[model samples]
Target: MGVVNVTPDSFSDGGEWFEPDAAVRHGLDVLAAGADLVDVGGESTRPGAERPSVEEELRRVVPVVRALAAEGAVVSVDTMRAEVARAAVEAGAAIVNDVSGGLADESMVPWVAHAGLAFVAMHWRGHSTSMQSRAVYDDVVADVCRELAERRDALLAAGIRQDLLVLDPGLGFAKTAEHNWALLAALPVLHGLGHPLLLGASRKTFLGRLGRHPGEPLRPPAERDVETTATSVLAAMAGLWCVRVHDVASTVRAIAVVEAAMEHAPEEGPA
Candidate 1:
């Protein structure tokens, strides 16, 4: 998966592709760089961001989604609104990558099932506006697993096929840096939810923080790709089903190597 931010306020690469044309171009470039899917998001879920109105979100993503789908790219709408998800899927998006895990919108699950689109149910609490307050977790791993399991049940009840589902641990949605690292280490546990896992740790704040000194200014999002790729490699080796990334070419290379090494490893089964 390749990350394509159509919104102007995402924590990373926000304004870089804010323009529709630029976003489309970036989509094409990512596909050429070996991204199997292009995730187009209109909302900036950076902590404390305001939610864009439905109209604005639609305007930001629908055209881009349409163009990419027309170009034969597998597009995923990174939205939490049923209206936007429905519109984007109608516009050619094949997947709904809702960061909210069907919590943000009442109609998202049923709509996704109705359209038979692949749905990524990312763990989320409140919307970005107040999600910071909801970040507290006594046990981050258990809490995330519990929440994701709840969402999975909702999707199943809403008529979505279990096989059409994917789970994301909501890397930076409301998680602290430590929480994010914990999730990274425990990613395999998320796969135990019985859904394919989608890891979206690319260029996140945690990676940037890792690159900074204790008292120095934090590294910027754009500068965290190398560290982010390192995490992605680890995630792949840990059995994550797919990784959402911005620098798709490098991630593809990294994943290819990981897969090759895993393939050639001596069998570890019963002798």
Candidate 2:
């Protein structure tokens, strides 16, 4: 999956594709570069970000989704609102990538179920503005897995098709650097929840913090593509369902190398 943030305040590439035409063009560019899906989000969910009005979000997302889907791109609306999800689906979105995991909006799960679209339900604690304060976990990996399981049960109980649902661990949403690292190290535990996993570690702050010197600023989000690509290869090797990324071409190429190498490896054991 490739990210297309059609907002003026996303953590990365804000305002670069805020215009519908530009967003559609970028979506096409990502698809041509080997993205299996284009995730279009209007609201900026960066930490401490404010929510946009529903009307503004709908105006920003629907047209871009329509244009991209018309051009044969598999589109996912990265939204927390049922209203926006409904409009985007009407405009040709095939999936609803809700960061809140249908927890933020009461109407989201039902709407998604009725639409019969694929849903990526990410584990979220709260809205972006105050979510960091809620990042208290006893054991980061175990806690995240348990919480994600709860979300899975909730979504299934809400009438969403079990096969059509995907779970995301919500890497940077309400997690600390320690929490993020711990979760990444336990991908198999998350996968054991009996659902396909979606990872959105692309260009996030946690990855930027690795190897940084004391008092120095972390790597910038745009420059973290190298790190993101590494994680993309890791996700592919871990058997993840998808990896949401900002730079799709590099990740695609790297994953191709991993695939080719794995193809030649011994199936049962090392030689």
Candidate 3:
């Protein structure tokens, strides 16, 4: 998966693709770079970011989704609103990548079930503006797993098909740098949930913080691609089903290397 943020305030690469034409082109480029799908998000969910109205989000993403789908590219609409999901699906999105896990909108789960599109249920504590305050966790990994499991069960009860659901630990949503690292290290625990995992740690603030020194500025988002690619390689090795990233080409190459390594690994003999 590749990220295409068509908003002016996404923590990374926000206004760079805010224009429909630019966003569409970037989606195409991502697909060309070997991404299986492009995730187009109109709203910026960066910590402390304000929400955009439904009309504005629709205006931002619908056209880009339409254009990409018209070009035969698989597309996912990254939105919390059922209305926006509905419009994007009608416009050509094949998946709904909701960061909120259906918590933000009452109509989301039912709509997704009716549409029968792939739905990504990320572990989210609250909306971006207030989520940072909710980051406290006794055991970040265990707590995140519990919350994600609850969301999965709820969605199942809401009529969403078992196979249509994907789980994301939501690397940065309401998580501290330490929490994000813990989640990544606990990928096997998360995989034990019996659902395909979608890891989206691309260019996140945590990666930037990893390169920072005490009292020094964190590395910018673009500079974190190296670390993001490392995460991709680890995720692939851990059997994650997909990784959402901005620098798709490099990640694609990294995953290829992982695949090749696995393919040629020595087989166990009478172990």
Candidate 4:
């Protein structure tokens, strides 16, 4: 996966692709660079970021979603609003990657079910503005699993097919740095829920804080590809179905190595 943020306030590459034309170009470039899917987000979920209104989100995403879908690339509209998601799918987006996991908007789940779209339901506590203050958890892994299970149940009740859903362990949302690492390390726990997992730790703050360099405070988002790939490999090892990443080529390369290793594992058959 490759990320294309059309919002000017995204944490990593905020203003880079804020314009529709630039976002489309970036999406095409990422696809050319080997991204199996392009996740186009109109709202920035960055910590402390201000949320954009539904109208603004729609204006930013619809064109890009339509264009990318027309170009034959798998397009996922990264949104939390049911109205926006409804318009996006009509415009051609094939998937909904909602960071709020149906908590932000009441109609999101019904829209997802009605459209029969692939859904990426993320673990979230609140909007970016107040999420940091709500990052309290006794056992991070258990909390995340419970929250995701609740969302999954809601989706099922809303008439969503089980196979159309994917669960994302919202890396930085309502998760302290340690909490993020705990979730990453305990990915098998989430997988045991029997749902396909989508890991979205690319260029996130936790990746930047990993084992600091000798003379560096911490690598910025632009410089965290190697660290991101390290976690990508770990995610692959955990048997994750897909990884949502900004650095597409490197993550793909890392998964390739992991996949090859798994394919060649020595084993006894029917012994």
Full-model lDDT for every candidate? 0.90, 0.92, 0.93, 0.89
Where does candidate 2 stray beyond 4 Å? 269-271
Deviation (Å) of 258 in candidate 3: 0.5
Q: Highest lDDT among the candidates is held by which one?
A: 3
Q: Candidate 4 — what's its lDDT?
A: 0.89
For each candidate, what TM-score against the reference? 0.97, 0.97, 0.98, 0.95
| Model 4 lDDT per residue over 1-271, tens place | 7999998877788589999999999999999989999998898888788888888999999999999999999989899899998898888888899999888999888878887888888998999989999999989999899888988898888888899889998889988899999998898899867789999988898788778866678778988899889888999999988998888989888889999999999887895
Off by over 4 Å in 3: none
Candidate 3 displacement at residue 39 in angstroms: 0.4
Task: Please name the candidate that would achieve the greatest TM-score relative to the true structure.
Answer: 3
lDDT of 3 by residue, 81-101 (tens): 999999999998999999999
lDDT-best of 1 and 4: 1
Sort the predicted structures by TM-score, highest score first. 3, 2, 1, 4
Q: Scored by Cα lDDT, where does model 3 land?
A: 0.93
The residue pairs found clashing in candidate 4 are none
Candidate 4 weakest lDDT stretch, 10 residues:
210-219
* CA displacement after TM-score superposition, residue 94 of candidate 2 (Å): 0.4
Clashes of each: 0, 0, 0, 0
Writing each residue's lDDT as its tens digit, candidate 2 over 1-271 gives 9999999998888689999999999999999999999999999999999999999999999999999999999999999999999999889999999999999999999988987889999989999999999999999888888988988998999999999999999998889988888888888788789999999999999888878998889998899999999888888889899999999999999999989999998779666
